[model samples]
Target: MARIRVQNLVKAWGDFRAVDDIDFETNDGEFVALLGPSGCGKSTTLRLIAGLDQATSGQIFIDDRDVTQVAAAKRNLALVFQSYALFPHLSVADNITFGLSVRGVPRAERERRLEKTASLLGVTALLGRKPSQLSGGQQQRVALGRALISEAPVCLLDEPLSNLDAKLRAEMRNEIRTLQQRLGITMVFVTHDQTEAMSMADRVILMKSGKVEQCGTPAELYENPASTFVAGFIGTPPMNLVAAAPKDGRLAVAAAASSDLVLGVRPEHIEFAGEGQEAVVAGSEYFGADTVVACRIGEQKLMVRVPGRPGLGTGAQVRLAWAPSNEHAFDARSGLRKSA
Candidate 1:
């Protein structure tokens, strides 16, 4: 329905740059996530796209039409804020149809659209209640209904699930994804949660320090991170990055080589073996489905994910092995992935 593009976008406050020269585009009807930690500019990027904040420089295009100077209301975009900004004094029905009334859409049309959106989001029964009377999840649905009632082709969400509990967040994630697909609307979501971005988005734009770090599909990011920052950020237990050196024409931990080179391996890739690099167990955490074992190869720490509980005690010596192909090499100084 809509394709959004931002080119060389930047947002600055005097000496500070919140968003710095970022470029990315979303396919029509695609789900894209802006993911990063706090102060990383993901929310700023989303606001720039929604026309809520003006960019310091660059162009914004919607369906190939330049909307850099367009007003937020004139852009034909709907936004759902993280706080679920509903008026407490207004009933759910009135809140959902408020925008329509402000734009002077006829009462009949407003009611018709409100009914359709309420049904779509399963909030029709709560139309008479006020925001204060609704639970968090219900309030979220009402907020979504307000956005959807506009029938806008482009929707922007800013950490919409952050306020909900874990179970509710999971439920809303699926619901929102389903709604996007069912309506064929393009969506840009902002979140710091890697799980949310990896599970929902068709692609993820990971940001750091106001710059674009990596942009790719979830599988691509997981399989091949561009830097040590990405390697440490995208996983549940994250990748284990330890000092390494060249030994026997191959890289080995604690060997004498360039101190500027680092080795990265996913927690799930490392395995306990009969003979390999030796390590001492530091501790482990059991998560029912699997266990995350913390081990140290010399002074550097590594986390290994293993199936079931190994029941290894602290100070226990173990041999760790992983396929060479599973290893990732990075330049320690630059934090960039090293070419094989």
Candidate 2:
């Protein structure tokens, strides 16, 4: 396993900067996720680390050795691309051993690694098949095997599970995490899906507009979001950010406060109470396990998550209440969280 460090990294093309002054480090054997929406530079950052893309400025260090100027092949990093990038003409066994063959590894050594990697990924039976003959999940395993055969200290994955269906994606998530732990390999996973990032990574680096927005454990980011963007991005239905006014040294949702402050509360934190702030139900979405009721308070709207079907119809009035400890405050002007 190896530790990775990126110092003031920047990647630019012409007048546009794809990555801007980013800095973060990963512990040995840690799973770190670079997470953000499209064009946020998460993929670009992974490319830079893999040496597939050069950093416009800054340094990259792996295991305390500077590798910023090194070529991709010499960096000793195995990368699993989003597309799986399998060769149509090659068998799964051949695909997995391609790296070793290219490096002039002995046929016997290659066979040994192929057997071990195949068994570890549970793809030994598929080794005789061509990529076109396999399912999406099977092809994904082959791609993973290709990376794992190298036994590299660091593995970089760029949305490796995006091509699969929801159920398969969930299965692969657990498989990949288990593999990483079993081998104690440091992994840097890039994804736009907040669920993947939060559920898989030991730590997450959330990016926005080509720069790091916040980097912390998933719990840290969820329980203590650094800004309005994070508050709205991390959760399933996201945090409800409503206009708020200062009321007796506390914040309360109001239309007039849109200029001064924003109050944030997760959908799960809100509950229906006999007496609280008055709101009119706008709509409800019923999932098997829970229901999300949309309510409007003046000009602001928020969603409340309640177990089972609340059966609240449109235009129904309800009073909402939440614990003070669950409330989050942010400056409306700057969109930054207000400090305690």
Candidate 3:
């Protein structure tokens, strides 16, 4: 579709800035996710891009054309909200064709668009079904179909999958990705779910308090976080962070019960050893494929994912160790990475 460029954007409410001056770009056919905690300005950024709300300052460019002041209708973007927003009284076909019909697209063109979209979304038989008759996941598909029928290069989704159950959400993630790639639309997704962002995005925009904490490929943020906030936010069984000092020729993890430095290792990257950093078992979680072992070394704890290690049950004594390279060094006071 079209490339979208956001430059030095700012959005404010009275004296409080909801979205700080930020810069980013989404390439043609790219699927970028704006991820953050609640009230972090991710949704505000989406509204700004969709022209649902105006920016307080800065510019927005779609296909290199300035449209910061464009009306939402003029921008021609397809936006799906967290709620499906489908018309309960309208049949699936009517819902999908509403956009075209409103724009005065002739019957022939509308039918053509509807046919292509229904087939793409596998809702051909669903045409006569009203929103109430369809399942939640199906309703979401129709919502997306409505957008797809627009054939706009840019698509904005505001947590379109949030309303579904876990299974439906999982299924829809793949469906959305497949459809996005098939249509080759430049899509901007806004969600507070880190797993969704990490699983589906081409690049992630991690936001905090209206400012960008970091923007990078999932691997980049997981491996080399720019700040302590990111370090704690990006991983499953997140990186271990404890206060530590690089002294006495070795670092002590202070949270590891007053050890020297905070030790950062992935849950899957840690190993149990007798001679390694001494720790007591704080907790354990067992999954069939693997078991997660949480070891408390001094006052701090680290989680390690191990396979076939049921022998080391909860409260068991063990030594936690990781490859030197697996360890991350952070400033004792700042908690920001000292070295990647």
Worst 10 residues of 2 by lDDT: 250-259
C-alpha positional error of residue 148 in candidate 1 after TM-score superposition, expressed in Å: 0.8
TM-score of 2: 0.98
* Candidate 3 lDDT, 116-159, residue by residue in tens: 99998889999999899999888898999999899999999998
TM-score of each: 0.97, 0.98, 0.94
> What's the best-to-worst order under TM-score?
2, 1, 3
lDDT of 3 at 158: 96
Task: Write the residue-wise lDDT of candidate 1 on 20-133 in tens digits.
Answer: 999998899999999999999999999998999999999999999899999999999999999989999999999999999999999999988988999999998999999999
By TM-score, the better pick of 2 and 3 is: 2
Model 2, runs deviating above 4 Å: none
Q: Once superposed on the true structure, which residue ranges of model 3 sit more than 4 Å away at CA?
A: 247-250, 255-262
Separately for all candidates shown, the number of backbone clashes (residues 3 or more apart, or on different chains) is: 0, 0, 18
Off by over 4 Å in 1: 255-258
On TM-score, the stronger of 1 and 2 is: 2
Q: Model 3 compared with the native: what TM-score?
A: 0.94
Top candidate when judged by lDDT against the true structure: 2
Error of 2 at 14 (Å): 0.8
